[model samples]
Target: MAIWVCRAGKKAVYVEEFLKQEKIFCTWDGFDYDLNLYDDKEKLKEKIRKEKKDAEPTAINTWAAQLMCLKEKMQNGDIVLTPNENSKSYNIGIIIGVYEYKSEVPEHFRHGRQVRWLPDIIFRDKMPQYMIYSLGAYRTIFNLKYENEFVELLAKLGIPI
Candidate 1:
């Protein structure tokens, strides 16, 4: 299963709230369009480029790539790690459904994917240094592909692999 690191909010203002609610995760609020509407990531990127003309190429790419992840790459069994800013812990969850566009949510968080937040929380200090580095990436969404490292993490949390 793939692992994804998602921040609850840019400033982490909604980490606890999100964990409490156990809803979906959203990113790139500026796009404003429902990412679920597009099937092709390239097409989405093109649209982003046209709409956000002044945005840097890197910014546009990051947004499109992450939107694509939410739309397609993340599967039902995939894990998600959303760091808890109030503590040195992560709010872990498993994706349970496909992409969803909730217009009722605040404008910044319209594109989402349902997640079943795991009951246990993992503290950063308990994880290995290498895994910690991977989790420290600045990107909003990424593939955490270190198999052994993840195994270690799950084991530490008493979660069966």
Candidate 2:
């Protein structure tokens, strides 16, 4: 996905339309964020200027993202899930499954990772099938490029694995 930075004031809305993009995140400070909604440049720019605009990462989110990334890389069968040192404490047991989120999870338990303390994650496609830890939460799957980043993130989080 591509990200863009635009100046505020007069041309913001027009620019948004011209760019064929619709979803806008109002980063304006002191304002409640409306995700998946549209906002003009002034609002977003004010957010940029205030420095209180965005949220800091929480441990849960960071951990969730890392797990999801690893799940995507998994192939079916038993595998060693290497965590970044910050989060290596997340040792898990044998994963007895591998499938996409949509097909695998039961309908009653679909709150993403939020609902489950330690849901199994799996990547549907790969050399081996995944154990499937973060089934509902992965926005995108991991490829080779993210391996180092995952390790770094977990290491920073304090996991030795």
Candidate 3:
């Protein structure tokens, strides 16, 4: 299965919300439509441009790709790692459900996926340098480059991989 790095928010502002809600989410407030409806990134980019008129073309492209990745590319059973700045650790979890637009929730967290979080948290200091570097990616959502190493680490930690 694929492994993903899904940041809770800038500096992990929504980490607690994610833990409490038992899910991971993306925050593109004005784009309320379901991502599954868009078959291509270009179409999504067009919609993003209309919603975020102030955003640069590059930013629009990036958002479109990231949103698509979260919605379409990521599959159920894929492993997800979300940072918890307060604890200075990462929470490991399994993606357990399909994407959903929860309109009743806060605007920044409308797009979401169900997750079954593992009980253990991987501390930053204890992680290998390679894993640390991989998690340093700037994007909000991305595939973890060191997938095999990550699984081995989890095995060492006695957590089911």
Candidate 4:
């Protein structure tokens, strides 16, 4: 029962129905979403109504497809963007790595020193992690711990996801 932010103007009339219908076509990222109300349990609960029985699976597929599509683009280092309907706001981020790793710091260095080239890269577990265009100057690396932020980044891209 995720609360979907909807325009509070004329479009509010069709929120749930529109979501039910659009789930068949695209990922439904709320537009003009009121972030302040996002965490308001009672408020959001009041705004989000259950979809018709059949629309439920469609919604789940919509979610999975959204995740899969974003995952694919992420494998290619693409960012995902969810543009606001008014075109004034967006959510952006990228996924930069798979399986986390230890620093590989040697016994001597674990306490202080770090070797220049001691880390290892595993191929099978690798996912084409990404860094946002904004971070290009900073050199996005595969080992960054920026919080599955990259996934949010995939949403900001023009890709289908």
Candidate 5:
């Protein structure tokens, strides 16, 4: 399974909410429609530019790519790693459901996927330097570059990989 790093929110603002709800979400306010409806990232980008006229070209591109990754690239059974700044720990889980538009939730959190979290929490202090570096990515969502090493580390920790 592919592994991904998905942040709850800047500074882990939505960490507790995500853990409580058993889901992972990304915020792109006003674009609440199902991402599956879009034929490709370019279409989504066009829509974003149309709706958010003030957004910069770079921001628009980033949002479109990230949203597409969340909706299309990610799949059921993929491993998800979410960092919790409050606890200085990383929460691991498996994506158990497909992309969904949860209009019932707050506007920023409308896009999400259900997750089944593992009971264990890996503290930052205990992680390797490479892992720390990789997880320090600026984007909201990204695939792990060192997937095999990460899986090996998890196996060593007695976590089911």
Candidate 6:
């Protein structure tokens, strides 16, 4: 299964509440419509660019692609790492459902992907240097492909690799 890192918010502001409430992982692009209208990734990106008139090309591409992946590529059983602000640690989760739009939630978190968050925590200070570097990326969402790193994390959490 593919592994992914999902940020809680720009500065991890929602980490504690979301985790405590068992809320799903989500993002804000101010997109309130269906994302599946355009089958082509590029076309969808162009649409997003128009919707976000002031966004730079790089931001548009990154946000649109990752948002699209939340609906299209990310699947059930895929791993998710979400940082917790309160503990300064990462919470592991498994995607458990497809994309959803919840109007009841806050505007920035309406688009969501269900996740079965694990109870185990991986503290930031305890992570390996390379894994720390990988998590240091500024992107909102990204693949975490270093098997050895996950192995180490799982080991520390007492979950067999």
CA lDDT of each prediction against the hidden true structure: 0.78, 0.28, 0.87, 0.27, 0.86, 0.75
Q: Could you estimate the TM-score for every candidate?
A: 0.89, 0.20, 0.93, 0.22, 0.92, 0.85
TM-score: which candidate is best? 3
The runs of at least 3 residues in candidate 2 whose Cα sits more than 4 Å from the true structure, single-residue gaps closed, are 1-55, 58-61, 79-93, 102-108, 111-161
Looking at model 3, residue 158 earns an lDDT score of: 88
* Model 5 residue 13 lDDT score: 84
Point out where model 1 deviates above 4 Å.
none
Encode model 2's per-residue lDDT on 81-146: one tens digit a residue: 322122212222222333222323333111111111122322233212232233222332222333
Give residue 117's error in model 1 in angstroms.
1.0
For candidate 6, the 10 contiguous residues with the lowest summed lDDT are 20-29
Better of 4 and 6 by lDDT: 6
What does candidate 5's lDDT look like per residue over 1-161, in tens digits? 88898998878888888899999999545786878789899989998999899999999998898898899899999999998875378899999999888778798689999999999877877778888888888898888888888888888888884
Ten residues in a row with the worst lDDT in model 5?
A: 27-36
Q: lDDT per residue, candidate 1, 99-151, as tens digits? A: 88877777756777778887888888888788888787777777776856786
What is model 4's C-alpha RMSD?
A: 20.2
- Please identify model 5 stretches exceeding 4 Å from their true place: none
- Top-lDDT candidate index: 3
Task: Provide the clashing-pair count of each candidate structure.
Answer: 0, 25, 0, 13, 0, 0
Model 6 residue runs over 4 Å out of place are 20-23
lDDT of 6 by residue, 70-90 (tens): 778888988888876643688
